[model samples]
Target: MGGNEQKFIKEAFDTNWVAPMGTNVDLFEMDLKTYLSNNVHVTALSSGTAAIHLGLILLGIKAGDEVICQSLTFTATANPILYLKAIPVFIDSEIETWNLCPIALEEAIIDRIKLGNKPKAIITVHLYGNPYKIEEIRAVADKYQIPILEDAAEALGSSYKGQKCGVFGDLCVLSFNGNKIITTSGGGALVSHSQNIKSRAIFLATQSKDKAIHYEHSEVGYNYRLSNISASIGRGQMEKLDEFVNLRRKMQNFYKQLFENVKGVSVFEVPNEDYFSNHWLSVITINPSETNGIDCDDLRLALESENIESRFLWKPLHMQPLHKDFPYYGGNIAESLFAKGLCLPSGSNTTEEEKARIQNVIKCLFKNKIKKKIKVKSLFPKRQRLFEDNMLVNFFTKNRLETS
Candidate 1:
């Protein structure tokens, strides 16, 4: 928690504003608006998923509608489609940003149109805080006249071409879950370009309660409003949002430096100067064949042995059992990423000692792998002779056999 979180919560309690709607919620929304520097309205809600559900509702998504979703994101990005009984047409990620591929997105739209199932909305995600090909994706969406639901859940402080991520979509969503850049303990907000959209979202979020004297209901509504206490936490987290982003970016740089000389390991990074990521989590892709048989899962297990936590990247939603049956566009890019990527621990609160421990584990793991290669090389004098003859195939074949 940030320094001011407790103070704001205490204020909420002292004033007895413990319910979902209060000054804290209002101020939290205002804080986000000011931080975004975009004239967008924010309606705080219970979760990022809830915010997504409401965004779809506002976008007029209904049963059997098709939504284009990035295939390499958290399930929350796609699950909301099911909540509305909508069909999700998943699109693969591009190699550059590990996000929705613009070309594939357009192809999906074209084919869906051919089948008379034109996509109602595009749900693009800024995966792991890296911005998607925003201009390109926007171009495709604009060409198709489809609204975008920007899932900036992992990209609160990220930007593309000086514009913040959360404002890019027709309706954008931000997550303040425990693992996000900022935490409201558990909450989210929907960002809209129009005040009316924001007002409608708030109205639907609070059980569609009309302004009548007696209990009334007109349409189905959700109890998705952010509580005052959570909003207070969000306000506090907002104060430190920039700091947290900087820290996480620093962690990314640290990983870049740590693996600078390491073979077969490449840190994921912004493709150009125009793209700026929050670096919410530093991730890398490993090629086992190039690294003497050290794979991503190997590295994860090595980290686990040291009592340090690491994780494989999100499995492509298109490949998941629940979503596999859904129509998916594009090729093996997302699949390859899921196979090779690993997410290193990158909490804003990570300590130097913890970093040193993680570094030692990684370094030791690689060092041992290299030593094994060298030892195997020593066992085959004929293969060593082949090295002098530049017969690389024989050398590698013998090496593989010995390692096997």
Candidate 2:
């Protein structure tokens, strides 16, 4: 926790504003609004999942309605669709950004249109804080006239073409969970361009009560408002958001540099300067050929044996047991990503010693077979089948590794 979080929490206690509705919550919302200043209104809630559920409702999703969602994102993105009893049509990711693929998205829409039931909304996530092909995806959504619910839960500070990820969709969600870039202990918020929508969200979140003096009958409501204590933590986290983003970016650059000599492993990065990611969790994709058959799972096991936490990328929703029968688009991009991607430890407080240790472990793995392959290739000369037929040479040749 940042040092000021306790101070804000103490203020809440000193003012005797311990309930959900208090100055802390109000300030927290305002701070979020100021931070995301695209004239967007923010409504802090209990969790990112709650924000998504509310966003789906606001988008008019209902029973049997269909929602298009990125298949390679966390379950929270698709669970909200299920909450409304809506069918989630999962679309696979592209290799470029590892987000939603535009071609597959359009194909899904065309197929759904053929069935005479277009999706009511689309939920595209900036997975691991990397922006998707926003311009292309937005064009497809516009062509279909489907509103987008941007799940910026992992991309608070990410941007595409100078526009913030959270401001790209009709309705967007932000998470301040304990494990996110910023923390509110456990909280989230919804951002929309319309004040009316924000007001409606607040009303629904606060139990959809009428403005009557006494409790009155009303529509179904949820107990999803952020508490004073959690909001206080959010307020403090917001104060250090820029610092947090900078630290994360620094860590990402460090990883990129460390992996420069590690064959078969390339740090996942933004495609170009037009995309700016928060680098929320530094990730890498291991090409088995380059790493001498060491895959992401192997690295994960190695890290786990050393008591270091590393994880494989999110499994596509289309592959989940519950979503096995859902409509899907795209080929093996999502599946390959799941098989080869690894998320490294990128906590804000990770130390230099920890990073060096991680680098040493990877170096040791490379020494096992990587050195032998290079030696055999050097002895055989270029264009001669070295250790074995592998994709690394093809990839390197295609990318012009001499210049890289």
Candidate 3:
């Protein structure tokens, strides 16, 4: 944690304004507006998920409605639909960006419309701080007259075509969870172009109360307002937001440089110059054939053996048992990505010694795989080795795995 975080919290206490609304919350909201400038109004909330739920409600989503959601993202992006009793029609990701597939999204829209259930909104995500196909997805949403609620939970500093991601959606959400680009400890904000929408969101977030001297509740409300204490942390985080984004990018570049010559791995990259991501988590796909049958799981195990924390990418939500019956479009792009992809440690505070250890483990894993394949090929032609290796035939059977 940065030193200034305590300063803001102190201010909150000093001023005796420690409720959900206070000086800190106002400062936090202003900071967001200044950073995300695009005629956007910001409302600090309890969580990014709460922001999405409220955004959908402001967009007229009600019980039993349908919202098309990207199937490859975290469940937080889709769970809010259930909060409103809205059926989340999942959409698949394209191979290029591992984001919402425009074609599949369009097909889903057409079919749903045919069934007389035109989706109330399209919930797209910029996964892992990578910008999705904004133009393509926006085109489909516009064509179908479906508003978009961009889940920029992992993409606070990411942009597409020079426009910040959160501003592209009719209503966008930003997360300040502990691990996010910025930490409010745990908080989020809703951004929108319309002031009315922002006002409505803030009103609903603080509990929908009628403007009366007495306690009068006109509509159902939620306690989704960001606490003053949390907003204090957000205000401090905003001070170093750009630094955090730059650090994240540097980490991604470091990974890209380290893997540039490696045969088995291709670090995930920005699709083009039009996209500028925070590179929240530097990830790569390990091709088994290129790496002598070494896969993502193998690398993960190696890292674990060293007590280093590396993880596989998220399994697409569509394939999850909870949403198993949900209709999903697109081929196996998301599934294939999940199988081969792994997210390396991309924390801003990662040390050089830690990096060296991580890289050494990966390098050794690949080198061993290459050498074993070569020895097997020499022992019994490529075809014979392929069959024999499956049966645990050692490259140096006589030498034996048990050495003196």
User: Which candidate has the top score in TM-score?
Assistant: 1
The sequence of per-residue lDDT tens digits that candidate 3 reaches over residues 247-337 is: 9999999888888888879999878899999998899997778876766755665677677888767767877777877777777777777
Model 3 lDDT-worst window of ten: 372-381
Report model 3's TM-score to 2 decimal places: 0.91
RMSD to true structure for each model, in Å: 7.5, 8.1, 6.5
Model 1 RMSD in angstroms: 7.5
Task: Return the top candidate by lDDT.
Answer: 1
Question: Which of the two, 1 or 2, has more lDDT?
Answer: 1
**What is residue 52's positional error in candidate 2, in angstroms?**
0.5
* Model 2 Cα lDDT, one tens digit per residue, 342-384: 8999988888899888877666666665422211111111221
lDDT of 2: 0.84
Quote each prediction's TM-score. Answer: 0.92, 0.90, 0.91
**How many steric overlaps are in each model, in order?**
0, 0, 0
lDDT of each: 0.89, 0.84, 0.84
Q: Per-residue lDDT tens digits of candidate 1, residues 253-325?
A: 9999999989899999999999999999999998777888777755765676667888878867887778868
lDDT (C-alpha) at residue 207 in model 2: 88
Candidate ranking (TM-score, best to worst): 1, 3, 2
